[model samples]
Target: MTSPGLPDLHRHLDGSLRPSTLARLAREAGIALPVQPRFTPGMGLDQALACFSLTLSVLKSPDAVRLVASQIAEDALAEGVTTLELRFAPQLHGGAPPAVIVDAALEGLAGRGGLILCGLYGEPPDLLSRLVAIAADRPGVVGLDLAGGPLPSHDFSMSDYEHPFAAAREAGLGCTVHAGEGRPPAEIRVAVELLGARRIGHGTTLLEDPEVVALLRHEEITVEACITSNWHVGAIADPMDHPAARWLDQGVRVTFCSDNTLLSATTAAREHELAAALPGMTPALWNRAVECGHQARFTRS
Candidate 1:
């Protein structure tokens, strides 16, 4: 049977642009890409990450943010995506405050041809309350997330950010944290137990602990699995070996995403296609993944 349509639950708006779009933007603004475009296709995780950071250098203004956001929405529409949750750190734009960046993003989506739900990414321990306040203030903002580099030094421990995450919960904002991607299983546990995360972004390491896996299944927490990102990061030796299929087989809710589409040179459709190459995955299972995304989405008035 033909695969059902794809829905991207976890994508960074800044990371979802087509390479041609990035090149055009760079040219229009007289900004140079950090790495040559040719290097992006086969670049490793660190290199890909560097490329994304370079893109951010050019995206340091409100007009750039608006342009990227609009392009992301248009790209999603072209992909036949019915719904997509785009995440980004609002503070990435230099001069403007986080709120203004978010407002500019919303403005970018105003006349877009399709519906796209946007969420703001926050680093824990420092900006959780500010992130929550943005969600509370913006009707278009749907959820809260923790996104940053994947390293022990970059990890946001719950011990450091519990109170702020609690504040977000009190504000009725839905929570999702990037855990278990490159960190230990204990970090994943903290996200669920301490941070009260309803969804775990890149919870690949959870498979190491059956109890943790069971808890995730029992709690009905969704895992946003970015296949290409995992492969690029060396988290999994190969895209074909990623444990997303195993997690799904064990009844864990796993949704596919393009963590940094430009860096990874992929899309939600491409992710699902790669997933299908894994053992035990079928079109039916892929549809279930989409359902998991819809279920995991933060819905509040």
Candidate 2:
């Protein structure tokens, strides 16, 4: 049965693989997966990351990219997703240029009959020019995102990288950053004031600073709220206590997302379910949250 509301706007293409698919790929490539951990009842972050790394390691060719992207689209279709904006850090997939990776992934989405928006992930300073150039060339590519684990020690304030953010704006590509996922709210501020981010990914820490919250609300910056992902990554201790719900209540434009479905063992529908189960959550509020996602979609032009 398909869920009524499943507009998955913030999913990682590499992170949406089914466990069985991952296993098949591992076996096919002769890659040894690390021992699965029992952190939760039926899921383990270590095992998931290991599988993802192995999959990326084996998926070094364009054919593998096509296969994986096709599988992702097929899975989304089965889940009743009418619109899916799949994000992936092409730089993570070695041995191919970003364009080749994106093109192969888009090829897989062919005949799916859904809106598919592509994005560039991570903070690759040197690849900024190439990324902007590619986005300029590809109409399917809608946005540029700074994702992955926080590079705390890396200098993110460089002007060269900021130029691409500006370039994306000029090129009509939506700009977003994975700020305040595990970092401080100041990072979120920099993403807006310094880098000109149109959307903030996992801005869970926004509630910590009232000024930052006000700024986000004032700017109408949409926060891509990934509840399960934040919980799994220790950004929040529990889904019930997640600040995203509070952000929504306070007029902050927050939208639900599945940041890394495979890693979090979640889907967009599951995210909605979790939000519904949260304390003080109501059906009306849940619907409003989902609607917010539709408006905040990167594919909305």
Candidate 3:
């Protein structure tokens, strides 16, 4: 079971849609369900994102997004996740204005969890700025995230995001960025120093640089580690080799998460189990990791 009070701070709502939900929504919309993206071991970044695209194809309307959001929350609660931050890119949902998408998702969340609005990589600056604006003053909106795969330019610098993220911070929203997943490890430093991220999503390459790890520990930045998803997406060669436990031992806060529950076919509980099985994980360390997760939550008292 997911440790009670342990928070999942890095879930992607769009990628967590249930197969049954997808089928029902497809039928209701008179849209055929696209071919399921088969998960090959180590399918790599391009193919992993392709899976999310398939799920997005079914979510054509805010109502559809709302339904999926509610169901995903229920599923998380069922799995014993006491707190969650379910994130999604509103701009990817459809032509509906971002506010509409945010409202639909917030309604579905129903106070069961907080929402993190995502600004996808490669999205136009104007669209990203609008997304940041939409997050402000929204009830149930606790955080803002920079997510998605690498842009064609392979640029993951903070230059394009600094202004909007500053606006996000000004609005009192917590900031978390998807850095070091497949990007250069230096980008993780940029995220914390420039973008003002308090948490990092899928920091797969974090341990590659000792300086970066030290910076995170010094700043109390949490790393959202998705073990199974990392292995499946080729971010890590093997789940056992993941450095989640090592990070904890090194004094960095770490949290286990199921990045895309449906896409990775895992759960919050399973992620915890994987973390526990890592080489340096002790019972005390495991408990501390759980405590760190609750500490890292963006929701305010």
Candidate 4:
């Protein structure tokens, strides 16, 4: 298990819905999921992402959103996670209004931590601006995140998100970007330089570029590492190849996280164990990694 004091800084609430809850919500909403919304080993990233679409279909109401968010917090607490930031894109939930969705999630968390509103890579600038506006106004919202997957579908450049991210920073909102999961290492630099990211989500390939690693250390940026999720998404073929240990040894801060608990079929306890087993990940470095999560948290209590 993770230390009871550890914080998961990079979870996606939308993708972490429990299987039983999903079935009940889908049944009540009269929505039929094409595939089971659970992750299995060996599934590619595309397939895992597709499961999120199925999860979103049933989360069309504020009540549904609230229930899922609240339960995720409860589960995290039950698993000994003292702090967690659950991220989700309000724009993707077609049923409820953005503010309503934000409120529902905040209500759900009930002060366990806070939400990190996401702006997807392919979304329009105006939409991103609106998301930033929501983050600015809501104290329950702790940060702004650049999330979404399958790089081929997103045609926009990193600079396209610069304005909204800058606005987020101006509003005192912490900024994080989902980069270097499957994209080239260069995009991670773009995320930091252009988007003003203070944290990086799924920086799986960060060790590939020494310069980028140095920049992360110089900038004091935290890297959110999701070990189980990386393997499920084929980001790393073998768990031993993960860069978490190397990053720590090289001075880049890393916080182990469960990116999508249900979608990755993992929990904080499981993630902690997996990270602890990685090559070169000593007990001291593992402990420091957990400490880094608390340091990197956007929601300061």
**Per-model CA lDDT versus the true structure:** 0.73, 0.70, 0.84, 0.86
Number of clashing residue pairs in every model? Answer: 0, 0, 0, 0
Q: Rank the candidates by TM-score, best first.
A: 4, 3, 1, 2
**Per-residue C-alpha lDDT of model 1 across residues 126-209, encoded as one tens digit per residue:** 566776777676767767776654445645445667876787777776778888876678878888899888888887788889
> Cα lDDT for residue 88, model 2?
72
How would you encode candidate 2's per-residue C-alpha lDDT over 88-207 as one tens digit per residue?
A: 766667768777877887687674522233233334575765676776777777787776544346554433357777777788777788788766899899889877887888887888
What C-alpha lDDT does candidate 2 achieve relative to the native structure? 0.70
Candidate 4 C-alpha lDDT tens digits along 129-175: 89988777688899998887536577676788889998888888899
Best by lDDT: 4
Global lDDT of model 3: 0.84
Better of 1 and 3 by lDDT: 3
- Indicate the TM-score of model 1: 0.88
| Residue 239 lDDT, candidate 3, scale 0-100 | 92
Candidate 3: tens digits of C-alpha lDDT, residues 1-301: 7436657878888788887887777787787765755455698877888777778878868888889889989999888898788999888888487799899999999998899999877666567678777876685898888887666685444567888888888888889998888667888998899999999988888888999999999999999999988898788889998988888999999989988888888889889988989998999999988888888989632
Q: Show pairs that collide, candidate 4.
A: none
Task: Quote model 2's TM-score.
Answer: 0.87
